[model samples]
Target: MSFAKWIGGALGWSFGGPIGAIIGLAIGSLIDGTAQQGGFLLGDGQTSRKQSRGTHNKRPNYGKQTQRSQTQSGDFEVSLLILASVVIKADGIQDQKELDFVRQQFVSMYGKERANHAFRLFKNISQQQIPTRKVCMQIKQMMDHSSRLQLVHFLFGIAKSDGIVVEVEVKQIYTICGYLGISSRDYESIKAMFYNSSDNAYKILEITKSASVDEIKKAYRKMAKKYHPDKVIHLGKEHQQGAEEKFRQVQKAYEQLQKERGF
Candidate 1:
């Protein structure tokens, strides 16, 4: 008989005669065997006890699932474009400097073809409704705090492309950084570094206030070559703009040091 019927009859036979007891015993044994085959057992079944108490043999798909989670959504597409627009407009001029930077950054991180497509996609998204936090949350979920902070730095780099970051761009970047959950101090630190990085670059290149004329020229050339936009052209147009701007500032720093030192 089936397990359900057996259970019902067995319970009903609590006060039945010996014949009822025998039938119940046989049915209970049959039900117990079936339960064991299906990963269960009666109270005293050794196989059930062992299986229940033993470690699971199944290997989890954690890595696969984690990778899947990382690429689960396409939510960053719009936000990245929005931020790109913000950075490009930061200097009040959407010149080659800003465009080149955006291109190179995307290309390095996402590949040239992908970067080109992304820029085009960004343009399209710019025309549409800017998505709300609900959409951005999906992208944020995929990124850890460090990655978010890095993204903010990239934004800052773009913002500083044209030598001067416009107030609108600064406010937009601050808002974007806030949405990304980056602390204000961290964002300010990143921005401050950008603002003062020409000096830092000069210091690193050993172009001091007392540097000679030839020394300043040599330093400027070295700095220009190091940050040359041509090297990152493979990153595409958007990225080249930023790198070009950086190279320009490198040249500017060298000139400033020269002027101060009467080079």
Candidate 2:
């Protein structure tokens, strides 16, 4: 499919906010040759024909009061592209490894054709100055909690792709977690997945080593429910592999705890 049609059909609520603006700029450079064909692009970077009618005249509602709708795979894809760019640049160096990781992950989740389209947009997005907080807040407002968690998981994968998650990258992801309304516990839970420490298992379970076996078991069940691949099933099967990775980590942590305590 054409890039314009893929974007036009894939996005939902994201076609109307700061994300929309970023996507608008990226597509501006991408589709200049096809501009006259009147694909998704319109005046001033507007992507949606329906939104341009009445919503375009009014200011975007970025407030917490705005009602969130079901997040589409395209919305998740766009958000991932923008945030991946932010995390990759957090350390002041755009390591090719990190870029390759992004491409590889996209190829794994989306087929080569779609991944190419996404990477093309990603390159354009990387050149601009993104207002990270605004973009994240928009995502926090519009995206479901499960999908948001998936985003954090994928980001940690990117930061770790270079073989070491730098301090700056950690701090950047932490700040993003805050803006995305992810709790400190949730942040640490996902963060532990990419690191090795004596207490990583506990962190993954969102608990402490001091907890009794019953508590550990309880935490395991809760976490298993939270990270289950089905939680993000609405996002489609392409995303299930990532969510399943998280779920497996939780099981590993629990099993490790069980063996240690012999319970």
Candidate 3:
């Protein structure tokens, strides 16, 4: 597929806000003799003008009754690119292993052709200075809870790709988690997956060692439900592998607790 078609068709709510601006800048740098210069594809498959005219002013409606719009694959893809850049540069050095991990993961999830297109965009994105708070706040507003959790999981995966997740990378991710409105508990739960600790299982389950058997079971059930692969089914099968990995980690954590507790 053409780069324009791939980007134009893949995004939805992400085609607006801070995320959109980041993407716009990336596309501007990448667009050359091959692609159209005057317009690009919007999520709806329409040709947008030089700017995303109608969308720049649009804000996510916030309320108890207002529901977040579903996150499309393109939205998730672009978000991942931007955040991965943030984590990779957190230590002031871009490790090749981390960059390879990003490419490999995209290839596994999106196939070779699409992965190439994504990497091209990612290269451009990595060169720019991103506003982490504004980008993350837009994501928190536009994306659903499960999708946002999935994002955190992926960011941790990116940070850990280089064998060891550096302290700076961890700090960057923690800041992102806060900006994304992920609670400390949920952040710790996902963070536990990438590190080894004596109480990692408890942390993965969002519980403490002092908890009773009943609480262990309860936390397991809650975590299982929260990390279920089905939660991100709307993003298509490409994402199920990562979601399943998270779900399996939750199960393993619960099982470890079960073996230790002997109940």
Q: Where does the lowest 10-residue lDDT sum fall in candidate 1?
A: 66-75
* Candidate 1 root-mean-square deviation in Å: 22.8
Candidate 3, which segments miss by more than 4 Å at Cα?
1-8, 33-67
Candidate 1: regions farther than 4 A off? 1-79, 89-93, 129-138, 197-263
Instruction: Estimate the TM-score of every prediction.
Output: 0.43, 0.89, 0.87
Best by lDDT: 2
Q: Write the per-residue lDDT of candidate 1 for residues 1-263, one digit (tens) a residue.
A: 34442233212111122222332343343455554544211112242223223222222232232221221012222345555765565445567878777777767755676466456545543333343343334335444443354456678778777677778888878877776676665565456547655455446354554666777788667756655766544323443555565556566666666666665
Q: Against the unseen true structure, what C-alpha lDDT does each candidate score? A: 0.49, 0.84, 0.82
List, residue by residue over 1-263, the lDDT tens digit for candidate 2.
34455455556778877999998898887686444544332211233333333433343477656777666677788899999999999999999999999999988987776687678889999999999999998999888899999999999999999999889999999999999999999999999999899999999999988999899999999999999999998777778899999999999999999889999
By TM-score: ranked, best first = 2, 3, 1
Deviating ranges (above 4 Å) for candidate 2: 1-5, 32-60
Best by TM-score: 2
- Candidate 3 per-residue C-alpha lDDT over 1-263 given as tens digits, one digit per residue, 9 for 90 to 100: 35565454557667777888898898886676336543332222332221233443454543323346777766787898999999999999999999999999988997776687678889889999999998998888888899999999999999988899889999999999999999999999999998899999999999999999999999999999999999998877888889999999999999998899898
Candidate 2 lands at a TM-score of 0.89
